[model samples]
Structure formats: structure tokens, C-alpha cells
Target: MSRPDRTHFAPLLRVIHWTMALLVLAMLFIGVGMVSTTGPAYVSLLALHRPLGIAILLLALVRLAIRLGTGAPPLPDDLPKPQKLAAKGSHGLLYAAMIGMPLIGWAMLSAADDRVSLSPSLALPAIMPHDLMLYWWLRQAHTVIGVAFFLLILLHLAAALMHGLIRRDGVWQSMTFGKIPGKRD
Candidate 1:
């Protein structure tokens, strides 16, 4: 595979980034809907949720591999040390959340002796033993992690806007479609 251009992400990475962004956003909303309702809509939301979570997990793994192989565009040279550290740390947390949340949800279901049905003819094997106490704890952890993930996303968005809008740095444009203004190479 071709390496990404110095000023922009690889095409595949950009595509997957946007796709997973939509998927993660939807998953968050579906999760909230699943927990906040008891009607038939809850069942529908769950059906959407299980498969989407698995999809996110799969995509995240692929994305991480690509990132490790290809790497990302460098941050602006003049960016402060603290901001640069925050950028790296936040990215690490986002990746962790991307990989962790679905696994936690799967394990939570497993502990409850529940099946994670991906389709009528397919399901995931349980990764945790059936234990009500464990299920309760896992469920709580899932909620907390979900909330944290949402906040992380907000922080990420803010940072991106700062790069694109306030700073007019190429950082945001690296992951996006347009050229990085004033960048020669």
C-alpha cells in the first residue's frame, strides 16, 4: 500500500475514519435509547446496537493497523508541548475506547448468559462466564466507559475545530477532503 502524503492521510484511512465516526456516533445514541426505553423500540434499538458494536470493533482494529503501518500527519511544529501531549494522549484514549467498549459490551452479555446475535444465523461466543454479580459490574462499567467515550469525542471535535477554524493549521485538513491551505508539499 502507498504511504499517506505528508500533508494528508491515506485515502483508505480517511474513508474509514469518517465511516467509523458515523458508526460510533450512532452506537452512542442507540446505547442511550436501549437503556432509556422499555417498549418494542428497545428491541429494535438492540438489534441495531449489537451488530453495529461488532462492526465498530472490527473497523477499529483495521484502522489501528493502518495507523501503525502508515502513521499520521505531524502536528504543527509551533504547537505547544502541552497541547501536543494532549493530542497524543487523547488519540490513545480514543483508540482504547474504540477497542474496549464493544469487548466490554460483549463480555457484559456473556456474564448475563445472554447471546450477542449478529444475525438470524450467527452469534458471538461468550467470553465471560455466567455470573449475575459480574454482569452487574460489567454493565455499570460499560455505562461509565460510554459516557467517557462521548466526552472524548467532544474534546476531539473541539480540537479539530480549533485546528481548522482558529489556528488554520493543516492538522484538521489532513484527515479531510480539501487541500491544506498554504501547504506547498
Candidate 2:
């Protein structure tokens, strides 16, 4: 038998989820775009990209705080223990990646002596001393971690689709549509 969708998510949670989704997707694409170019052409793009990444990092921090403070909707009674555990683990990994990726990116830029400014010609203080080896390592770290994040996203999407398709649940609804009331067991 099929199950029902619960108006599970709070409005704020939905907003945070989608906002982060858009920003993260942009970051993923821009990370690729940055490495794909050479010369001074995409230097400006990297400039924009770095600051925007930082902005996303800040926002992620805020979202993380809110998530910790508020309770998320619990899984339906029908969910098995292993599936529930997987859901919890996937979310934890997602949050860690969300926080870690941009931060490592920031550290990556900081290691390269890239002090970004909001506008052209303005300057900010560099956080770390510029070392070629450190910059190279951090760049590689950022690339590897970004790819991991992409993989995690695939798993996340698969689980969400599973809730909608196989489980006949509204896991997406909570985050997608406004909260649907949880079904009484």
C-alpha cells in the first residue's frame, strides 16, 4: 500500500535548503569553470567566484545554526531503522561538505595570497602567507572535495527520489512544497 505526504518542513527550512542548493550548484559549476580557463580572461571570473563562494559559506553557517536549533521533521513510522540511519548519515555528510568545501576554498585562496575585494582595485588583508606548495596542495584538496560533494549530491537526490517513489512519502515535499502534515501512525 502507498503512504501519504506530510507537511513536514518548516518554511524557513525549505528556504534554506533551496537557497543552498542553488548557491552550491553555482559553486560546483564555477569551480570547474575556473580551472578550465587560462590567462587573464577568467581572472575576473575567479575574483567574482571567490567572493561569492565566501558568501555561500557564510550563509551555510547561518543555515547550519538554524538547523541545529530547530528540530527537523522525523521520518515516518514505517521507515526501517537502517533506512532512517542512512537518511541521518546522508544529511550529516551533506552539511559537513557544505561547510567544509567553501572553507577549504577560502583557505585555498588565502594560501595563494589572494585577498579579494568587493570591487576592482580595493584590497583586503590576506589570511595566510603565500606558499606555492601550500597553494598547490590546497587547490588539489579543493578539487577532490568538490568532486566528493558532487557524488554526495547524487546520493542525496537518489534518497529523496526514493522517498517520493518507492516509499510513497513526501521527503521532498517537506523541502519542496510547504509543510504537509505528517500522517498519524
Candidate 3:
């Protein structure tokens, strides 16, 4: 058999990438809905957020391992230096937020002396000591990071559209459209 094409991400990585994308978006909206309302539905959204955050964290760890081990396709050589740097920095920030956000949320819950339920019946052990001040700080940091994470996602989407549409570059296909049959004319 021939070697798998390197232009596209490995299939597992692609699956995880899209899966986490949907999950993260849902989590963000659920968080907003949770804060914007009152009563039973709000409580349910809060419950869902914790488990979804954990799922994103677990998937991110696997995605990071695959990224490091297999590596991503290189950006086009014609790409400008500033845009390339922004691409790299944005990607790094995305990964940092993906990994950090859940852990911060987990720690915040722990510091608040709350049991971190992975499910209605399952719970995670506290990674941080119970401290009201720590909980307050972590809560604030989580909010700030969540906003930054959303902004980074918007930037990432804009860059992807630039590569796929305006630039007609294969960078987007490296993660998305997969390998094409022939080289660009």
C-alpha cells in the first residue's frame, strides 16, 4: 500500500479536532446560558459544563500527543512572516486555553470545596486545596481566559478562511478539505 498523504491531518487528529471544536463551542454557549438565566435549566447547564469541559481536556491531551508525534504540515513558503508568526502564536494560545481552561475550572471547584462530578455518579479528586481566596482568583481567571479563548477561535477561523478562500492556499486543506487529486494549476 502507498503511504498516507501528509497534506491532510491524520484521520484520528481530524476527528478529535472537530469533536473538540464542537464541544468547546457548546461549552461556551452553555456557560453563557447558565449565567443568563435562573432556576432548574440553569442548574442543568452548569452540570453539563463540567463534564463537557473534562471531555475537552481529555481530547486535547490526546490531540497534543498526536500533534507532537506526527507533526503538522508546514505553512506555505509564500506566506508572510508576520502572518506565519500570528498563526503559530494563535495555535499555541488555542492549545494553552484548551488544556488550561478545564484544569482551572476543576481547581476552582475544588478550591470552593465542591465535589467535581464527572457525571451524576462519578467525581474527580481535588487538585487544589480548599481556599476561598484561591477560588475567587481562579474564577476570575477562568472568565478572562474564556473570553480570550473565544477571540483566539475567531482569529483562527478568519485565518482558515483566508487560506481556503482568498489565498487559495493548501494550509486549510491540511486540516480540512484533505488532499486534492492534483496540484494547483
Largest lDDT belongs to which candidate? 1
Give the TM-score (vs. native) of candidate 1: 0.95
Report the Cα lDDT for residue 113, model 2: 79
- Model 3 poorest ten-residue lDDT run: 1-10
lDDT of 2 at 144: 89
| Ranking, TM-score, top scorer first | 1, 3, 2
Question: What value does the lDDT take at residue 155 in candidate 2?
Answer: 86
> Tens digit of lDDT per residue, candidate 2, span 15-130?
87888888888878877887788957477668777777777878888888877666576677788999888888888888888888877776767788776665677655666678
The count of backbone overlaps in candidate 3 is 0
Clashing pairs in 2: 6-180, 7-179, 7-180, 7-181
Model 2, residue 7: displacement in angstroms?
5.1
Ordered from best to worst lDDT, the candidate numbers read 1, 3, 2
**Which pairs in model 1 have colliding backbones?**
none
Candidate 2 yields a Cα-based lDDT of 0.76
